[model samples]
Target: MSALLGCGIVLLAGCGSMPVTGDVKAVDASQPGDSQVQVYAVAPREGAAPSEVVDGFLESMTSDDPDFRTTRKYLTEEAARTWKPSEGTTVLAKAPNRNGPSLHDKERRSTETSYRLTGEKVAAVDEESSYQPLAPTDYSQTLHLVRGNGADGKGEWRIDIVPDGLVLGQSDFKRLYRSVNKYYFASGRTNGQSALVADPVYVRNRTDPVTRMDTATQTVRTLLAGPTNWLRPVVDSRFPTGTALRKGVTSLAPDDQNVLKVPLNQKADKAGQGACRMMAAQVLFTLRDLTSARVEQVELESDRGRLCSLGADEAEEFASDNGSGAPDSQYFIDDKGRVLRIPGNTRGSGDPEPVTGPLGTGTVVMSAVGVARDEQHAAAVSANHQNLYVASMVADGELAGPAVTSRAKKAEDRLSRPSWDGRGDLWVADRDPDSRRLLRLANGEGKPQEVTVPSLDGGRIEEVRMSADGVRIALLLSKDGLMTLKIGRIERHGPESAPKVSVEDLRQAAPQLTDVTALSWSGRSRLVVVGKEDGGVQQVRYVQADGSTSSSGVLPGVNQVQAVAAADDELLPLMAETVDDGIVKLSPGDNWQTVLKGGMSLVYPG
Candidate 1:
């Protein structure tokens, strides 16, 4: 008898449990050891046939033991010692084909072997405890079994050899796996301010045999792999491309003082001292979240010598380096398309005040507007969407430049909401059917400059928002008949007078979300998302940059949300436009507060 145990990625949703297919009676193969031990202890049935032995072995695979020592009872002595369950686990959509394990007689020998352990592999878990969603595929393994003498000297079936690790159904995987947050930094922040951006991903729980350091190593590897496709451009990693731990090293080794000694390749050694310290900061923040031990410091080493060492306290100095911090006031376009502002965290009923500009007079019907981080500038789109205007935020502030319009023929196909980066550069996406691209108005004025965004695949950008630190952008995109939330990093090259701007590493932030209507960054690495699930009602929720949700369920008080805005506090001074077009505000534990009767579009400074 041969058994194949393997795992793959891509598990389908809603596949709950595997029902028993045939009349194979469920056997209560209990163990003789202390029942209190937290291990899978199923004793082999005496005088049992090969098929019954295979059934008991499969049942033992589901136990949540720290080690598979008890599970080894179903195997021969040699096979028990040779089996390494931690190699990897294969999660299946359904239980294996138990009836297919064929037993073959040996020629004058007390041994028989079985063949064919097969199922649909959906997801996989590695020895490091990381979970990867994979494409659905069929998997088959062969198990070798032997007919041996039992403790009572009777004939018994025992598995002599099997593929590494265990195979489980989707239900077992859901019960065993957990999601955790890994931290990375935003790429472009002015003045060296850095903030932590959480990348949520799946991993094995503490009960798994994987140690804390091994789990930490998996998290580090993911971080080194860079942000997921959607978050890649919006965030930055301290470890440069091609920089990784020394070969043959699986986990980080920390000293008695909790100082993690990380050995990197030559690429890391070339990074200067300042760069090395920032790299250490990323490691410190990530490890702190994974291990209970105080990761007080990180010592980065290269083949040549010590590259740099960073103390935990030094991270605070670069708090905004990731472009996470943003302006706190909530700005919006009112019923008449006039620009207005409201105190972000106010409790009492507050009237929206018009800002200082032609936009406030309603002379120009404004469709959208973006407030700059300094609160001194504003980018406005006309009600027709044909023309874009930029001016000062002060009272009667003069126009910064002449009206700007794209070459597109239709108004709706023209510019999107205008956004401002830390350097005061204005950005807008032109969704013209004939010519789709992102245009920038340097310092919120002057002629339009085209910014290259790779792999957009001709999808129209519905809306774009720049981060406060000026290094990243969040996008609402309509591509291939689906609305997606994507993030990317902004790279500038050449002289300061005529810089070249390109958006690269574009990736989807919410791949499972089918109908994303509105999204805005609430923290350095967090966003308040409003969307609908497949065939579900419209809802609001919070998600990490890596596309994992930190909040439970959707935000309450509305059948559908039209627009959403966020500020960077824990309680999250969240505001949204309801299906009825009324504006509402949400606090951490409070119901939606309808602050205004009617509103157009709203935004918080990037």
Candidate 2:
């Protein structure tokens, strides 16, 4: 595994084989076409003093150019050619502190002054375009300014020394950069259906006139370049190794009919019709966020002829197989260890009923349980947390097979709540210090197969929840003694042979949050996270699958949140377990109503 350290977060990009082989077009420079043009802007205004020069340069780093060449004007001739903007970037929550114009040398009147920028670093992106969650910490950077003779022979400030990367405030960073997800194939299949995993990255937003089309071009270019450093290992892209738009074709704007024409080299023409469709699907999904409703189809063209075309309506067919609808019922585990169900639309009027199976008979003791997406199968952890059991939910059905034992020597370091994926696979983490691993059970029965997770270093997984799409997994982990929530991509290799599953590309969804106790998938692209920051009360908040918080307010009336669950129904019903073990339902307006008492391990189907 290869790793890139960011703040306190370490991103892992494991090595894996791309199972499918297909021809993809490479960018051809000889081809004639209308591509986006690049425009340069004037540099920052000249400053008279060292501090002013340093401040102006720092502010210019957030300019609208895809490259920081405009900002480079602040650097001296030597520094301009040596500076590397792609080295890495440090994202800060606020503007950096300006420390001093201290003299570089004490003898005589020093001609050089050094100014230091200090602030709280929130995240970092490496040269490979991998974004890592960073623990908030003081970050300091220094740039030396030299007094030099100007055009008129008067002294002017010029930055002679500085770091390679850029730094900007969180608000400015968010405004200037847009987050877009690239689609890749999941490790496993559901009902013989292939799934698409989402890999998100930040790009310059579409606010600049000179680089207005850069967003689409960069998004497509990055997708063709493959998943970011952290996700490169497990996931596979349909685009061939050399696949890309023709060299001069940077602007990929859609025509009047909302159709995008992506001309490629002849290699892409060799791809089979099916493979071509898959390639188009990847492009369609990645551009979906940027184009929104304007994009209706994508046509792949080569120097020879049109390879294939994919319509927005059929994108899901060739891309993700997560399904088109949501579940109609909410699910939970009662204090007595029975699986309970609540009609989503009925919210406050109905009494919860035990699921029809041995789980409802009160004969078994379960500490945690997960219902499959179909709601017909379930995997449960014993009250002791050392054993795992699988059972059917039919009326009067009994648990199947003996309980699976844990490898942990201590009882507390046992199995966590199991999660079911769209493929009907049950996943759980065994926290046994002696044999820490993630286990996947097929069809909720028998011994589990061990799956590889991102290099945790010393971190431990506390909970795991698979998205309804089975393309992502939400994890609450404890690293460096701090509880944090992260998202990891699931990659399955050699599907026809001995298929193997590995989790890689771990990134923070709520980097600003700590003491995350529990989390659950609330919607196709959203999660309900239960966590609190230092000196703050435990509360429930909604977050995107990528780890960004949603504007949806936190759940009310809870000092401590223990667990949460969301039904797939259109209304997106939600349930939470409080400190007292009472289950509360979140109303449409963020209102909370006690629905049941003595409820724990609340969960929805995979």
Candidate 3:
């Protein structure tokens, strides 16, 4: 017998109680345990009772069984044949509790036995492997079992009807799956140049039960499948519709020279050389950080012949603005209200210098500043926080009149710190109580336009930050003395000459944080959030755009953080403004160190 089966039998033997009579007791197989421990499923013993069968199956779902064949053993022939485990996954707060073996027919003694499976649903992973966090709610499902004859010529109990997909505890789900990013081209290109956007999804950490593919292969299949529903409106997949991996290919690995060769189906052969190259680029980006061995190149092929290939260097054409082409300089407002910059590649407490612009020259005192991704222009909020000014950083020049101004009676309700998107547009929130709105300025010079947020739901916009891809925006909203962080999709409709922009489908990005003080986009699908949980101290942590938490998300504690900033290039140090430390930076594997003795509103180019 295999070691898996051996381990399973040992576990089953330890159950201690036998079910002989018609009285079937509920079995709770999901107990909290070490997440790193591997679990294996045991097949039903001959003449096993219904409770044993159900318990075995539920435990099997949490195991790393390659094809889930052991789990199927607990089901009837019809149920086994029809069950689709790949439909989706439901993650609960803990192992689902088995409620009762209630009689399916109370009037008479029936062969059918039923049990209620209940738990607190915390999240769901759809068929596309996109995870969405759900407000905690009660979850209930039913399992029907029938007595039948086993292949061993003995009476046995098997599941006749079962819930679709897999139900797993949060810890088990985390142990079995990991998040991976699939690359797609942004729908709207700037200056006629395309940039790749990341669409993150979960994949099995080991071999998948449904497809029997390794993690890398499963990720590739998901990429070719297409983007998730939330991101589909703003991104385009390079793979042709119906395109898929060559049938029967289950595993993929880089060659000795770190070249990954992907064989697609016949549909991919229709792509022209340029389109084929783009497809290869998508693959290269998706797999670049997936494997231990660096994938230096990607070659696409069909049964007919080689379609196209892309190398790590050649794929730079599709690189996003956040890519590692150049380091981003960090900026902050000094105690004197002048904008100062730290060189991008500087190490440990580099000297801060004033930028070559009016705001930096003290010509116009500022309280906050946002540098454009190109580092050529900056938007600054007046020291009084009522007016926003945009000026060139490449050369000293007279500052233009306020590009945007607020009329609120109080300084705190006037204007928010400005932010620049990858497309050179500026975004800021007008917190005026009488006229709360999110405003955007085209090219940072045009008149500010109020962007509609249909889902604001009476909440006031406190601050605004734009993603580098221009398809998403992060907002800090205040309502009823509570603050929340939300991520909204930026949808551009109508014609390019006069487009209608609306921030829609706002989802909670940091549901754990009761009061979010500040946040910044840290990577393609991650953010550095500074906030406090209910009745907890202030914390700085990393959170995925999808709102899922990781074991390593929490960072070293920083006191009284007023604002936080991170670069798309994660290697750069993280900067924060604090009440006691002034401007401080935390480099990789190091503690927070003071960068400036007295500074505020620290930021990196968006």
Name the best candidate (by TM-score). Answer: 3
Which has the better lDDT: candidate 1, or candidate 3? 3
> What's the C-alpha lDDT at position 497 in model 2?
37
lDDT of 2 by residue, 93-206 (tens): 675666765664476234677867778888876765456657788888888887777676656767888888777666555655666787776543435566666777767665
TM-score of each: 0.70, 0.80, 0.93
lDDT of each: 0.68, 0.70, 0.83
* Number of the candidate with higher lDDT, 1 or 2: 2
Q: For model 3, how does the per-residue alpha-carbon lDDT over 1-606 read when each residue is reduced to its tens digit?
A: 467544432243212132335553333343333334556666777666666677677878887766778888889999998988889999887767765678755643356788778888988999999988776889999998887754655457789899889998887788788888898988866467677888889999768887889899999999999999999999898788999999999899999999999999999988999888899999998999888899999999998988888999999788756333567888888878899988887853678899997988888789999988888888999999999999988898888899999999999999999988876789999999999889988778887888889988899988888888888899999999988899888888877555788898898876768899899999777889998888999999998877777657899998999899998888889898899988888999999998888888889997
What's the C-alpha lDDT at position 460 in model 2? 89
Q: List the candidate 1 regions with Cα displacement exceeding 4 Å.
A: 1-64, 67-177, 184-200, 212-280, 287-314, 321-327, 345-349, 394-396, 420-425, 441-447, 466-473, 479-481, 487-509, 549-553
Clashes (N, CA, C under 3 Å) per candidate: 33, 2, 0
